[model samples]
Target: MQRRLITSVLLGHYLSAFTALGIPLYLPRILSDLAPGTPGWAIGVLFVLPTLCTALAAPIWGRWADRNGCRLSLLRAHAGLFVGFLLAGFSPNLTVFVLALIIQGTFGGAMAASNAYLSTQFKGGDLSRALNWTQYSARLAMISGPILLGLLTAQGLGLDLYRYLAWLPLLAFVLILPLPKDAPKHGLASKKAEALGELPQDMPRLLAVQFLFSFAMVVTFPYFMPFGEQLGIGNDALIGVLYSLPHLVYLLALPWVQKHQGNLLLHGLALLAISNALQFWSVHAEPLFILRLLSGAGMLLSFVGLHRCLSQRSQKGSAGRLFGWFDSSGKWAGTAAGVAAALISQSFGIASPFLVACLAAMAAMVLARPLLMTSREIPA
Candidate 1:
C-alpha cells in the first residue's frame, strides 16, 4: 500500500470509531439524567438507537464512497455528525434524543470508505496489519472512552453533555484533516452510486452475518447493566466496570486475532456461538462478568474475521458500499434485538435478551456457510 493511502485510511478509521464510541460511553449517564424514573425498557432503547442508526447509515455511506471517493463525503459526514451528535446531547426528551439518533444515523455508516480505498491501493500484509491496528484503535476507544466519560461526567463535565459530545465529531474531523486527499470522485458507496451499479453480490450474506453476529452481542447490550443491577452486581460505578468487561478482554484478544489472521471465519463463528451459549450460564449476577468477558473475546474474533472477509471481497474496489450494507444490516438486527429485548423484558425479565442472542447465534451458523472455508485456509 502507498504510505499516503495507509496514513489516510487509518487516520479516518481511527477517528471515526472513537467518535462513534463516545455516545455509548455516555449513554447511561445521559438517560439517567433524562428519565429519573424512566423504566429500564426505555433506557435500553435509548442506549441502542445509535447502533441502529450506524447500522442504517453504513451502507448508504459505503455506496456513496464507491461512486464518489473517500475523502470528500467523509468530510461532509463528519460535519453533519458534529451537528447531529451535538443535537443528541441537547435533547430535552427521549423523543428528541431518538430524533438526534436518526439524524446521526444519516452520517454514521461503517468504515468501508477508508478500508476499501486502502485495500485497492495497497498490496501485501501491510493492509491487513493496518486494518488490524485500525480495528485495535477502535477497540482501544472502547477501552478508554467509557472510563474517560465516567471520570469526566463525575467531574461535572456532563452538565453540558450534549454540547461536549459535539467535540467528538470535531476531534475526529481534526484527526481526519491530516489525511491525504481522496480520489477526486465522490465518497462512500451510495453517495455516488450510479444507475445499474451495485456492490459485491456476497454483500447480502456478509451483511446477514454482521446482523446475526451483532444480534448475538447486542442482544445482551440493553440488559448488561440493568440485569447486573437486578442481581445486585454493583452500583453505577461497579456497573460501569462490569459494563466494560467485554472490552477489557477484547484488548487481550486483539493480538490473538491478528496472529491467526488467516482462516478466521469458522473459528470466529464457532467462538461466537460458544459465547452465546456461555451467556446462558450467566443468568445470575456472579457469573455475568466472566460470561460477558468471554462474549467480548468471541466478538473481537468474529468481527476481525468479518472485517477480513469484507476487506478481501472489496479489495477489487468500492468496499464502502459492501461494508456499509453489512454495517446497516447489523445495526438493524441489533435494533430488532433491542426491540425484542425491550418487549421481552417488559414480560419475562432480563434473561430473555440473552436467550434471544443465543438463539440468533445458532441461526447464524446456518448462513455462515458462505463465510466458511472449503478447508482451513482463508481465501484472499
Candidate 2:
C-alpha cells in the first residue's frame, strides 16, 4: 500500500516538472525573440508571478485536501495545469498568456497535496526516503524537461512552441489516469475559514530559514538567461543544457548523501549554503554550469531535509496541515524574492539580486539552528 501511494505521488511530480522547468527553458529565448516593442523583460517579470500564485493558492487547496484527500485535489489541480498550459500554447496576446500562467500556478498546487499524502502514508525511517523518491522523479523530469524542449526549439520548429509544449502535460494527464483514487475519507482538518492566528510556534523560525533558501534559489532562476546573455552565451538551446546541469547533480548525489549522512537536515543546510554562495561568483558561463551542479546538490539536500523535518515532527494525522504550511512558506518566500528581485534589478544592476541572495543565505545559516533541533524531534 505504501509503495503504491509513493508511485502515484512520483508520477504526479513528473507531470509538474514537465511544465515547470520546460517553460523556463524556452521563456528567456522566446522573450529575446518576441520583443515587438515591449522590451524583453516582460517574460522574466511574469515568471515570478506564477510561482507566487502557487504560494498563495497552496494553503487553500491544501486545507481542502486535508478535508477531502490528496487524491481528488491532485486531479483537480492537474486539470487546471492542463488547461493553463494548453491555453498558453495558443495565447493570442501576452495578456492572456500571462493570465494563463497565473491560473496554472493556482491550479498546480498539487505539490502541497502530495506532501500531505506522503506524510500520512509513510513513517520515521521510510518517510524521507519515500519523499526523496518523489523528489527523484521531479529531479529527473526537471533535468530532462529543459533539454527536450531545447531540442525541439533547435530543430527550427519554433513557431508555436507553447502550443507544442501543451502536449507534454496532456500526455501526463493521460498517464496519470490509471492511478487508483485515494480511498475516501470524510471531511477532516478543515479549520474555520476565519480562523487565522499567530502561525505555529515553530513557523517563524522555519519561515525565516525557508525565505533565505527561496531567495537563494529564485536568484538563480530568474536571472539565468539575462546572466547568460551578459556572458555572451546566446544560443537558446544552451539554456536547456544549462538548466539540466544542476538537476543532474541533484539526482546523482542526493541518494548517496542520504545513505551516508544520517543527519540529513544539517547536511542539507550546509550543502545548500555552499551552493547559494557559489552563485554569487557564478557569473562566468562555465563556472555557472558547475555552480548549477552544486546548486542541484544544495536543493536536494534542503528539499529532503525540510520535508524530513515536517514528516518526522508532525502530530498523528496532522501531517497534511503541517505540509500545507510547509508549502505555503515556500510560495510566500518565492513571492517576496520575486518582488525584491524586481526592485533590485530595476535599481542596482543585473547582478545585484544575486548579491542580495548571498546576503540572505548568510542569514539562513544563523536561523538553521532551531530548525535542526526541530527535525531531531520529528518521529522516524
lDDT of 1 by residue, 76-175 (tens): 6667677777887777877787788777667754254455555545544555555566666667776676666667788866526666667766675675
Q: Please state the error at residue 271 of candidate 1 in Å.
A: 2.6
Q: Write the per-residue lDDT of candidate 2 for residues 1-380, one digit (tens) a residue.
A: 55665775677667766767566646766555443455556755676767778887877776666556666666766677777877776776777778788988888765666666666666775777776776677778766776677788898644277666666556655545665654333454234422331235686687677767777777656666676777678886686567567667777887676564345555555665666566655656777777667667767777777666555565433445566667778778777777787788779866677677667666776787776765554434
Clashes of 2: 7
Would you estimate the TM-scores of all the predictions? 0.80, 0.79
TM-score of candidate 2 on Cα atoms, chains taken together? 0.79
List candidate 1 stretches off by more than 4 Å: 1-15, 24-53, 86-100, 123-125, 182-198, 229-239, 282-290, 374-380
Q: Give candidate 2 regions above 4 Å deviation.
A: 28-41, 156-160, 170-200, 224-244, 274-296, 315-317, 342-354, 377-380
Give the best candidate by lDDT: 2
